[model samples]
Target chain A: MRVFITDTTLRKGMQSASLELTYEKRKELFFLLSSTGIHELEVGVPAHSEEERDYIKYLARSQHGDKVIVWNRANIRDVEASLECSVKKLEIAIPVSDFMIKEKLNKDRDYIVRLLKEIIPYVKSKKLYLSVGFEDVSRADREFVIKLLECIREEGADRVRLSDTVGVLNPLQTNELVKTASSFLDVEVHFHNDFGMATANSITAFLSGAKYINASLLGLGERCGITPLEEVVFYLQLIQGVHTGINVKRLYEIVNYFIDMTNIHLAPNKPLIGKNAFTNKSSIHIDGLTKSKRTYLPFDPEVVGSKAALAFGLYSEKANKLCKK
Target chain B: MRVFITDTTLRKGMQSASLELTYEKRKELFFLLSSTGIHELEVGVPAHSEEERDYIKYLARSQHGDKVIVWNRANIRDVEASLECSVKKLEIAIPVSDFMIKEKLNKDRDYIVRLLKEIIPYVKSKKLYLSVGFEDVSRADREFVIKLLECIREEGADRVRLSDTVGVLNPLQTNELVKTASSFLDVEVHFHNDFGMATANSITAFLSGAKYINASLLGLGERCGITPLEEVVFYLQLIQGVHTGINVKRLYEIVNYFIDMTNIHLAPNKPLIGKNAFTNKSSIHIDGLTKSKRTYLPFDPEVVGSKAALAFGLYSEKANKLCKK
Candidate 1:
C-alpha cells in the first residue's frame, strides 16, 4: 500500500526544547525532506509570529516539489492568517475532547462545530485543499469524534486526522479508532510518543488502513516527539511491503543535519537509525555473520544506509567452532 | 498471564560496545535488579573467562532473592562450565537456523540435536532445572524449530525460549510465532531491536500468551540491545494491567544506577523513562491538566516515579478563558 507521509519537522519540530532551528536550518531540512520522497510538509502556523508567517509565505512560493500544507487553529482568524501564506492546503485543528474543549480551548464542542461549518466553506472558496485535525482525539468521546467528522465531511473537507495528543492509545485502540474513523472518510494519524508506542501505533494504524501518517526528522517535536520518519518507512518497507517512497540513503543525512542543528544525540537504541541497531557483538553471531551475514542480520543495514559494525568483545573473535565440523 | 522476565543485564548487556560495567558496577546493578521485583537473573556465561566464571559462581551463591540462571552453548563443555557455577537452573542455547548451525557452529542441525540428547540427560543428572534456548529462531525454519522443541520437551526441559537473534520479526509475526510455539510449550521471548520493534514485538509476544520475556537494565546489550526492561514493564502495567510485581516507584532509581555506572545518558525522548515522556506543553494540554490531569495524560507519571514537567512556551501561561470555561 502507498503510505503518504506528512513530515512536520519544520513545524512541530521547532517546539522541541532541545531544538532551535534557524530559518536556514528549516529550509535545509524542508528540502532534505522533499528529497527523501516526502510529498507533504506541515509548514508552521503562520499566526505564531511575523517571522514564522514570512517563512510560511516564503515556503509556499518556494520552487520545491513538496505540497506545502499550512497549520492553523479552528478560528477564522487563523484561516485568514493562513491565506496570507498562499498555501494551497491547510489543516485546521480543533480540540474535540470534552475536557479539552472546556479546560484547554475554553470553548464547547458546539462552538468548534459551528466554527468549522462557517470556516470550511470559506477555505473551499479560496480553493485550499483541507483536512480537519481533531486535537487530543484519544481522550475525546468516540461518538463525538464521529459526529464531528461527519459534519466536516459534509462541509467538503477532503480528509480528517486523529491526533493522539497525549500519546495514550495502544496499538489495538489505535487500530479500532482508525478503523472506525476511516469508515467515515480517508483518515490520517498524528501520534505522540509519550508511551513509546508511537511507532508501534503507527504500524497498527497502517494495518488498520490509515492513509497518512505523521513523522518527523529525528522525531524532533514536543515532549517525547512523534514517530521517527526513518523508522516508520523502514519497518513498513522491510516487514510489511508498504512503501513510503523514501530514499533510504538520505535518511542518515537528514537526521545528521537536524542533530547538527539541535546538537541532540539520538538514542543509541533508537530502532533502525540508532548507533547500535546493527552492531553485532556476540562471538557466535559474528562467527555466523562472517560466513553468512543473513544468519545474524534481520535486514542488510545498507538497506537503511548503514553498515554492520562488528563489536570487539567475547563474540568478536572467529572461534574454532566456526570452522568445518 | 504471569510474565517472567529474565534480566540478562550482566550477561548479554556486557556485550554492548558502549558498556563496560566493572565487577563493582555489576554487583550494584544486580542487587538493584533484584529490588525491582525481577525474579530471574541470567548472570553470565561461565565459559567467558576465569573472572566471568568467578562472577557467575559468586552470583549463584549470593544470598540474593533472584534466581540466577546460568547460560551456556549447546556443547557439553559449556554445560560443564555452567555446572561449576552451582546454579540450580541453566539455559543451553543452540542455533536452529541452517545458516547459524552451518556457519557459526560449523555443524549441521542434526549434530546440534544429537549434542542436546547427550547434554540434556547429563544436565538432568545434575538435578538442575533447564530451558533450551533456540538462538536466532526468527529466521529458522518453523518445522525444524517445532521438531527440536518436541524432542527437547521429551527430555524433561521445563521451558523453551524463542530468540529473535537478528531482530527480524514484527509484532504480527511475533504473535504468530509465540502463539504457535506456546501451544507446544511455555515459551519465553528474547528479542533484539534491529528494526526498532523489539519492545512492540515483546508486547505482542505477551499478548500472544508468552509467559517469559527477556529484558536488560539499561536496554544495554549486543546490537540494538534486548527490549528495554522499563518500557516493557511500564507499557504492560499501565496499558495491559499485567503487573511485573515491580515497585513502580523505584524504576527511575534503578535506571539511574545503571546509567550512572555506564555513564550513558538516557535519550531525552526514550519512552516511559525519557526526560520528556511525561513533559506537557501546549496551553491547551496544560489547561486540561489543571482541571483533570487524565484529560492530558495517559497515566500519572508518578505511577512510574516521574512527575509532569510543564514546558514553558506558547501555552505555559494560564489564560483567562480557561478559568471561565
Candidate 2:
C-alpha cells in the first residue's frame, strides 16, 4: 500500500529547543521539502504568534501553496488566525485524553464536543480541508476515542489525526489504534520517538490503513522528537515495498539543509542521513563490500543519493589479510 | 516472559567512531554496567588486540567475571585468545548469510558447516558456554538459516544468535525469524538500528521467545549501531511488564557515565536519555505538565532516575497564562 507523507519540520520541528529556523530559512526549507514530492507540509501554528501567522500567510501564497496545512488549537481564535493566513487546509488539534482534558486544558469532554460542534462546521463552511487531531490519543480511552471519532465523522471533517503526543505506543498498539480510527474516517498519524519506536510505529500505522503520516526532518520536535522523515521514507521504499512519493534521492540534501539551517550536530550513525550510515569499518563488512556489496549493505547507499566506502579501524589487519587473499 | 540483557557497550559500543573509551574508562564502564544488574556484559573481541585481550582477562578476574562474554571469530586462534582470558563464556561469531559467506568470508556454506563442525565441539569440549552468532541473517535464505540452525543444534552449542547485521528486518520479520530459530534452540538477537527499528525488533524477538538480546549503550556500533540498552530495558519494564533484572534507575547514570567517559555529545532528544527526554517546551505540553505530569509524559521520568521540568520557548506566553490560571 502507498503512504502519504506530511512533513511537519517547520511546525513541530521548530517547537523544540534543538532547532530554530528564521523566516527565510523556513521559506527555504518549505521549497526544499516541496521538491521532495511529500504530499503535504504542516508549516506552523498560526495562533502561536503574529510572526508565525504572517509566515503561514507568506507560505500560502508561495509555490506548492496547496500543500501547506496551518496548525491550530480547536478554538475559534486559532481558527480565525488560520483563516487570516488564507490557508486552504487546517489541522485543528485538541486534547482527547482525560488526563490532558482535565489537567492541561482544564475542561471536560463535553467542552470539546460542543467546541467541535461549532468549530468544525465553521471551518468547513469556509471551504478549508479540516483535519482534526486527537492529542494524546495513546492514553485516550478506547470507547471515548470511538465516540469522538463518530462525532468527528458526523461533523464532516475530511480526516482524523491520531497523535501519540508523548510517543508511548508500540507498533502493535499503534496498529490497533489506527485500525479503530480508520474504521470511522481517513486517518493521519503523528508519532513521537520517545521510546525510539516512532519510525516503526509510523510504518505500522500506514500498514493499518493510515492515509497521512506526520514526520519531521531528523525527527526534530519536542522531547525525543517525532518520526524521522528520512527513516520512514527510505524504510517504506526499500523494506516494506510501499512507495511514498518522496524523492528518495533528495533526502540527503534535505537532511543536510536542515542541519545547516539549524546548526544541529547529528550523530554519525543516525539512520539514513548520518555521515557513517554508508561507511563500513569492520573487516567482515569491508570484505563483503569488497566482494559483493549485498553481504553487509542492506541497500545501495546511492539509493538515497549517497556513497559507501571503507575505513580503517580495529579490524584493519584482518581486512588487510582479506584484501591480500 | 522474562528477557535477558547482554550489554555490549564495551564491545559493539566501542566499535563505532562515536565512542572510543580509554582503557581506564573502559574498566570504569564495566563496573558501571555491572551495577546496573544486566545479565551479561560482552566485554570485547579478544582477538582484536593484545590490549583488548588483556582487558577481557582483567574483567574475567574482576567481581562480575562470570557475566563477561568474550566475542570471537569461529576460528581456533580467536577461541585460543578467549581461553587465555579465562572467560567462562564465549560468543563465536561468523558470517552466515550467503552474501557474507561467499563475498566477505570468501567461503562456501559447506566451508562454514565444516568450520562449525570443528569449532563448536572444540569450544564446547573446553566446558565453555557458547553462543554462536550468525552475522547478516536478515538477508540469509530461510532454508539455509534452518539448515544452519539444525547444524548448530547438532553441534551442541548452548544458543544461537541471529544478527540482523544491516538492520533490514522489521518487527514482523523479526518475530518470524526468532520463532524459527527458537524452535531449534535458545535464540538470542543482535539487531542493527540502520532503519531505526532495532529497539522494536529486539523487543519483538523477545516477545517471540528469544531469551537473550544484544544491545549497546546509545545503540553505538558499526554503521547505524545496534539497539540501545536504555530503550529496550525501559520498554520491557515500563511498557510490556517484563522485568529484565536491569536496575532501571541506573540507566541515566550509566548513559551519562558513557558520555562522560567518551566525551560524546548525545542529542538532547535522544530517546530515554536525552536532556530533553523529560523536558517539556511547547505550551501545550507545558500546560499539561503543570496540571498533571501524565498529561504529556509517557511515564514518570524518575522511573529511569530522571526528573521532568518545563522550559520557556516560543509558546511561553500561552504557557504563562495557563500557569496563572
Candidate 3:
C-alpha cells in the first residue's frame, strides 16, 4: 500500500524544447516538490557538467525530505562522478531490449546483463542506495527482465525500474509486467506519455504493486514526457483511495511555478492542474453544478488548490434566459 | 475485434474556450474528417439554434463515408429539430445515474425509463437510425443500467452508449462496465478525460468488446474532454495491432487544421499530433537514433504524415562533442 514518487523534473523535464531550466529554477522546483511529499528527486546528471555536480551536491546537502538521486549510465564513470558529489542514491539505466541494446549501445542483452553484474558491485561497495533500471523493458523479453531483476537483486540492488522507454505499453500489459516483476523485487515503473497512457499505465503498475512511480512536472520529458506527477497523485488520492502524504492542495501552485520557470505553455485541458480541469463551461453543466457540484465535477477543486466557477460568458447568458423563463 | 470511432469534433470540440466554428470552417473540418475515414461524426446540435440547424443540414446532405449523428435530449422537440434537417441518425442521451436523474434532471431513473419509452417510438416512426446513450451510466446502478438497456432494446434502439459522464471510472472499472453491458447489447464507451485516463479507458472498453468509442479532435469537450481520436487510433494500431481503416497519415494534418480553425493552442506533448510528439530531444536518444531510429522511436512519423528530427540545440551539441572526441 506504500507508493513513492521519483521526480525527474531536473533531468527529463529539462529535455523539452527550449526548457533548459536554470540552477535557481531547479532549486525552486526541488523545494516545492519536496514539500509536497514526493519521495525522491532524480536531481540531475552529475556526469554532465561541473555545475551539475555542484548542484547535486547542494541538493544532497540541503535539508529537504526528498532523497536526492542522480541519473547515470550503467557505467562506473557516471557513478564515480555522482559519488564525488556525495550523492548517496543512484539510478543506473541500461538498454535491455534487443532493439535498444543492439542499436543504441552496439551491444546485446547478455552484454547488458554482464555490464550490470560488472558495475553494480562497485555502486553497492560505495554504500550508495541503488536502483537498476532496465531501459526499454516494455519491448524486452519478460524472461530477460526477470533474469535481470534476479541478477540485480543478488547484487544487492535495493530497487528495480522497468521503463516503458518508448511509451508503447497498454494498461493491461503494464499491469502484468509490474505484477510479475514486483513478485521478484521492488519494482518501479518509468513510463513515457508517447501514446498518452502513461498516467493510466502508472496507476495500473502501482495497483499491481510497484513501490515507486517515476513522474515529471507538467508531463515534461524527452518526447511526449512521462506520467505527470500531479496526475499520479490526484488519481491515487481520488481513484484508488490511497494517500501519498503529499499536500495535494498545493498541486496547482507548484505546477504553475514550474510552468513559469520553464516558459512552457500549459494545456488548459490538462487534468487536475489545467485551467479548465475544474472550470464548468456548458450551461447544462453549470446548471447541474448550481444544484450539486459533484453533478459535473468528479472531485472538489479545493483538493488541488483550485475552485470551480461558472464559465463566465455563456453560462451567465443561460442563467439570464432561465430567469426570464 | 471491431472498434468503430464516432468523432464529435464539431459538437464537443465547439464547446472549447471561444471556439465557435464558422459555417465554412465547419464544412472544411467535416470534409477533412470524412477523408480520414472516421466512421461517424456527431455533428452540431441542430436543436441549439437556426444556424446550427443549417450546419447540420449541410453536413447531413453532403457526400461522405461518415454517418451524420444528431444529439438530442430525452425529449421530442430536439428530435423534431434534427428530423427537419433530414438527419439520418440520432443519439438520444438520457441521464441514468441517480445523481444526474435526481439532481440534474429533477427526475428519477424510472421517469427517464418511461420518457425513453415515450419518445423512442416516435423516433422509430421517423425511420431514423437510433442509438440511446445513458449519460452518467458509470455512476448509475449496474442493474438499473441493464434494465434501462433492456428497455431501450425493447424499444428497438440500434446501439447503446455507456458514459463515464464525470470521468469517474478507472480503466478496470471501464472494462468491467463495458464488458458486462456488452454482454446484453451493442455498447459504446463515451469517456471524459477528467482523470486523464479516457484514452486508456476507451482502449480498455474497446478491448473488452465494446464496439464504439466516442472521441473528439484534441479530446475537446465540456470539461477535460473525451479521449482524443488520434490517441485511440494510434494505440489501437500500434499497441493492439488493430487496423482502424483510418488514414492515420493525415492525423496531424487534420489536427493542425482543427487548431488553425479553432485557434486553440495545441499541447507540444500531445500524443500523435503535438509539435513534440515526434521530436527527439534527449542526447542519449539522438545518439541511439544515429545507429537506428527503431532504437528510440516506436513508430515511423510518416505513419502520421510527420517527420522526426533531433531537437535543435542540445542534441546538436552532443553530436558535436562526440565528433570532437
Strongest candidate by lDDT? 2
lDDT of 1 by residue, B215-285 (tens): 88657777778788887887787767886877666866888666766677567777776677666665655
Candidate 2 vs candidate 3, TM-score winner:
3
Error of 3 at A140 (Å): 1.2
TM-score order, best first, reads: 3, 2, 1
In candidate 2, position B207 carries an lDDT of 77
lDDT tens digits by residue: candidate 2, A42-119: 999888888888888999998899999989998899999999999999999988988888888788999988988899
How well does candidate 2 score on lDDT at residue A82?
90
Give me the TM-scores for chain A across all models, comma-separated: 0.93, 0.96, 0.94
Can you tell me which runs of candidate 2 are displaced by over 4 Å? A318-325, B319-325
The models' CA-based lDDT, in order, is: 0.78, 0.86, 0.82
Q: TM-score (chain B) for model 3?
A: 0.93
Name the docking class for model 3.
Answer: medium
True contacts kept of each: 0.52, 0.65, 0.62
Model 2: CAPRI class: medium
Quality of candidate 1 docking, DockQ: 0.48
C-alpha displacement of B305 in model 2, angstroms?
3.5
Q: Write the per-residue lDDT of candidate 3 for residues A1-325, one digit (tens) a residue.
A: 6789888988888777647767887888888888877889898888888888888889998997237998999888988898898977999998888788777777777788788889999999988899988889989988887888888899899999989988998887877888888888898889988888898888888888899999988788877888898888888887678877777777668888777766687678887766788876666777888889899888888767678865543223564565567
Candidate 2 displacement at residue A134 in angstroms = 1.7
Ranking by lDDT: 2, 3, 1
